[model samples]
Target: MNNWTRKHNKFSVQNRLTPTARELWQWLLDEMPEGSNEIIDLRDFNKWVKRTRGFPHDRKTVKSAAQQLLDKGVLTQAKSYTAYVWKWRLQPIRVLMPPPFRKPQKKLTFQSEIPNLDPSNPQPLKDEYLTTTTDLEDAESGEFEQKLQACRKAGIYYYPKDAQFMHGFSLQEVLKAIIYFLFNRDGVRHPEGWFKVCLEDNWAGKEKERHQLRVQWSTEGLFEAIRYCNQKMGMA
Candidate 1:
């Protein structure tokens, strides 16, 4: 499955918001569904906010974030019946589109419009070496062994130096991602060399995908988890 939250993942960074403001704003984006008119009474919201880490039901902090979004045209607030009812709005996701056609000087070639066939592009390539079942088995024969060995050898060369990283991600988790990438990606000239590169990003893209599907989770899933924690702590 494709990443549904990918577009929203970097929201705070893209908006250049302060840490507290970003948290509050992101809470809004994640609290209600996109393109939704679900209005939260400021009082109820502040009650919930008190259960969170930052902003803590502070009207000044909350309003500051809401106004920032308003000024940036990212959200809107409404007042009706002489009550301060605020609804955090989300901008419709903007998709990148190429400009309208610019007529070519002498018409284009079929190859020009398509992306180059680079492994970095992550497109699947035809396996000219693996035609028959025997050939396929031979190709993958020692690949996993090599990858597992590499994983062990580089046990210290990964994130979560201990299991304290997010959700207890550790060496085994890293190896799983490496193995999946090895099997699914374009041809790798060297297993060890390829895995070395994967370690840089901690194979986070793959882990996030798995987490998304496993929990059927979205940003809102974060809220549910937090709420549970808050309840256990007698804060909610």
Candidate 2:
């Protein structure tokens, strides 16, 4: 959900990695939110690993694993301010769904249905959106329409261009951005104008309560769908 981070399929990225290197790479992915742009301090991670694994691995041991990931282009080292502290960023290679081979297949569709609100009896907002996926034009466009409808249902002013601009994020993330606007829209004269800025920066992912809501689909889910496509192609 982090703006700087992108969703990737863990299984796909785990391909062809050494056991130690794979473990370390998986740890980095699990330790941080998907697509997080924050720099990871390896010293702290190593300490945490020692506590969890019940064995103190030498600095060289962990560094060797990191080196493997670096060589494989799974991680990138950042310019660190101190020699003692090493900062690293996970950068998984982009994997695409292989094209259909034998025959044409149905398009993947993501379904979302917002509850029709009763104006006479106002109730507190809940995670009441009903969702189901089926065949559609594409996941992003279908999700955009669903999210747009949800915004209208919630009395939020969401524009088509705004939805199109934010099509890069998954359905759930886009919904979270909408929820973020609602939670923070108090005292603002123009909710629509403020929402544009929120979408640009993705303030929803930063909110603590944003994680509490049940999201319909995540960016990771989209990539997982791609993985499914790859599996169908016998390339996963």
Candidate 3:
């Protein structure tokens, strides 16, 4: 696997890693032979980044990042000083979109004023809206059930009210919340509580943003690889 190279491939949870942390991980995967332990000296990594990544990182910064990775379980400290070991893990779960969840509805325009309407009569409008949107309600309910089952599979149980609250968001957004929970759940003791807070604060959007950033970073890496190859061919 030493010569194995993957390009334009998506990482399991790229947004969870900082730049230095990610570089350190890549360095471990590259420099450490399989079933071997090596000292994680940042000075050597500094040279590597200068030569390959076209940038330089201070030893202190790299060391701090390494420590952070250790604390986060991304790297394990070996018995020897400064030496570390890395492990491979399964990829994150992917959320598959089922058939069109809901049909788009035409825009609704409310009248400036309604004549012959009693101020005390509130049931008519509410009942009419519910009747008109029954199909939409059913679609959203089905989608909510799908997301609930997914969370259950991931061992994230949501209460009845919690499920109702989550139903307010799109299924894709809710799934992002689940992904966020799974990726960053290293020290979380109460997953259900964490998920409830996540829903209340709408952390799903943050996950979506991270996903976008990961895609952008991956694209940049792909281009950098291409440029490196071009430079090497030119030298040859």
Residues 1-236, model 1: lDDT tens digits: 11123233234435654433444445565567555665655555566555532324346756665666566555654433324466555564452122345333443334444467543332232244225535644544344344445555643233321111111123455566656665645665444434433543356566778887978867888899998998999963
In model 2, what lDDT does residue 174 have? 64
User: Estimated TM-score per prediction?
Assistant: 0.35, 0.32, 0.32
lDDT of 2 by residue, 35-112 (tens): 344566667666765564344456776677677766766666555655335566666434222322443333435442
Q: List the residue pairs that clash in candidate 2.
A: 5-35, 6-35
Please identify model 2 stretches exceeding 4 Å from their true place: 1-16, 92-236
lDDT per prediction? Answer: 0.48, 0.55, 0.58
Which pairs clash in the backbone of model 1?
Answer: none
Evaluate model 2: give its TM-score: 0.32
Question: 36 in model 2: Cα distance from truth in Å?
Answer: 2.7
After TM-score superposition, the amount by which residue 38's alpha carbon in candidate 3 deviates from its true location, in angstroms, is: 69
lDDT of 2 at 10: 31
Query: What are the clash counts of all predictions, listed in order?
Result: 0, 2, 0
Q: What C-alpha root-mean-square deviation, in Å, does candidate 3 show against the real structure?
A: 21.6
